[model samples]
Target: MKYPLLLRFLQYIATLASGVGKRKKLFILIYHRVLDAPDYMRPQEVDIESFDWQMALLSKYFNVLTLEDGLQRLQNDSLPARAVCITFDDGYADNFTNALPILQRYKLNATFFIASGFLDGGRMWNDTIIEAVRNMQDSILDLSELGLGKFDVSDKSSKNQSVREVIQKIKHLPFDQRKNYVEYIASVSQNLPEDLMMTSEQVKKLDQSGMTIGGHTVNHPILSSIDLNMAESEVLENKKHLEQLINKNVKFFAYPNGKPEIDYRENHAQIVKQNGYLGAVSTQWGVASKVSDPWQLPRFIPWDKVPHKFMLRMCRLYCA
Candidate 1:
């Protein structure tokens, strides 16, 4: 069936199902970048057109709330039906240049989790691999010396696959080792975009515009890969930096690569609480309710391109 017709039908069903139970569910939608146009290397990230319609649908159907307000309401058991909070991770510059206007157009607000270490001109390690592979002069990327396999980068498909494989291979390496490999990759890749991440001013602008600014970390490190002191430093230092940048008390955090017990662990949750964050989010998929842990709240993103399928998946998340 066509999306328009199916969407209307699902909307009716969603409205009825949303109010059927006393359980107040909070669905947090996670995003990284809303691109100006489709990016072949980052096909999973939504472009402006897709983001626009998605935001429009949320504005029309769901009671979207700020992360702070949503969490508070969940604790009070006063959440409205189909509660959702929008969130963006990694502080991409496109978020300010592209996503914010659409969000404002829909009269919605979102939380942006910034990695302070990569603000201004610093690029994330993963981005280095992606850009390097994208701009590679040679068809074959030889990483055999690093024990990472060589990859074909002659075409878009091969380049995309190479980028993913390289990142996955080195993502969990010890901080210094990861840094070394990323640096090596950067040296070989030419003309990487320097403006990929948000500047400190852009982050400040997001806060001033009534959006929440949350800490991601200083270096965007995997907390579990580092020592406890380093982990605490990464979390506390990031919170301190963001608070200083916007001159607002940072209230929430999203773990870097937020996989529980893998990217971060229980102690890291304590670190966030100890450093004064009200809550934190993980990449885990679920709907948050009163019984949910504020520190390790789950988040999900519906990737369905069809509007009706997207709406149905969100409703199913609540039911799940």
Candidate 2:
């Protein structure tokens, strides 16, 4: 659940105090899309103005590095008292056109993890629904008539919980099953462009901008739901795919729907390390410490509206 305003405000106050103890961890921030599109129907949770402000604030106290550089600093014991790295998942086009300029302006670099399937014909299941919900020209979809069974998409309010519930329903099936289902729904709901992803050309732009690309599965799936053989294949195939496409050895990963106890498991970590990834990240909200599993590195999502209070909460994490 997203945190309440006041409580999160207090949390931001805590981020300022992140300088406690011997200071032995790295903070990784994970992002998806940047908010700047004109369509409210396609709401990106992280906006550009908010991102600008947050990075400005972060720069004052932390040395923002790319994910690879962060790992290297940790390995060499040369990270600053408070260090932070920026990473993005899914090779969204915005990461190329909207995001790279900002990071370049700040002289900070980031790592972008890609879902190979979507590079040509892939979209995360949730995003397919989101794009469709945005372009409903009729402003209403009679989902009951569509016979979605128990799941209802008729209520088209743009509220967070409403959209989340629908996503959960869509993601309920096994990985392949759910993605195919979402694609079917999207095709009927609103016919979108064939590619909502960064093309090979776009990825090259990011690489030129000093952004490293990491492997994030061939198709972004909840890895834990599939069989062990499928899971290993998923990881290895994505690494090989990205290595060939980007012409660089992909050494890092951020699990899709990355939660340590839920979306990923110990076995996933073993394969990642054995397959030659230097580190992998999870959506766990604490800072990354030496004791922190490199294969299970932690990251926090920066919301679209990052007020000063939110900054305080982030500061507290460092302090805590």
Candidate 3:
């Protein structure tokens, strides 16, 4: 069966299971870039209009709560009916410019997990790779010499696929190796964009204005791929940096690439707990429940745009 049809059937069953009523589980919605125009180079981005609509829907149908409050409720096993928390990973400038307004319009609060190393005019390695790949002068650049496979960047679709393939190949590599590879690509490609991340001032302002600022590693390195000491440093340094920058305690964390037992592991969760973080979130898909591990909280993004379909997807999550 087609994916959409399957999903629709599942949603229907979920609706029947609960009469499409709100569940007691806590839903943490995650996002990345909220751009006025969708960043073609970063296809994972949500445009401002779509974001506005989503927030409006959440405001109307869900009991959106602050991250701290939601976590406390989860801890006490007293999560409100249909509890929800909004979060943005990899603090982008557009979070301040685009997302902030929509959030404010809905009178909602959100937590932003910042990769400290990207502040003050720095870009994540993935963004660097995307910029480099998108700007390549040659349609079919050969990288077999680097021991990576050759790419066919003959058109927009091909270039996008090439970018994804290269990033997938290097993402789980040790941090230094991935950085070097991305830098090498940037050197060979042309017209790399500058400073895609939020500045220290922007971060400070966001925190001051009531948004929770959280840590997301120093350079967004996958914790399980690096040495334990390095991973600890990444987690600790990011927390300390955000604390000093925002002049407030950085309480929460989100794992880089956040896959359970893949991008991060048990030891990394231990590191986060040892660092005094209240809890850490992962890219794992599920609603938060009383039995859920606070140190490895799972989160997911809702992708449907149609209102009823989106609501049904939320219903599915509630039942899942």
Count of backbone clashes for each model?
0, 17, 0
lDDT of 3 by residue, 98-118 (tens): 999888898999999999999
Quote the lDDT for 85 in model 3. 95
After superposing candidate 3 on the true structure, give the runs of residues whose Cα lies further than 4 Å from its correct spot: 1-23
Clashing pairs in 3: none
Model 3, 292: alpha-carbon shift in Å?
0.3
lDDT (C-alpha, whole model) for all candidates: 0.90, 0.74, 0.84
TM-scores of the candidates are 0.97, 0.85, 0.92
Off by over 4 Å in 2: 1-21, 37-44, 137-161, 304-307
Candidate 1 per-residue lDDT, tens place, 163-228, comes to: 998899999999999999998888888899899999999999988888999999999999999999
Query: In model 1, what lDDT does residue 273 have?
Result: 94
Where does the lowest 10-residue lDDT sum fall in candidate 2? 152-161
- Runs in model 1 lying further than 4 Å from the true structure: 1-4
Q: How big is the positional error of residue 215 in model 3, measured in Å on the Cα after superposition?
A: 0.7
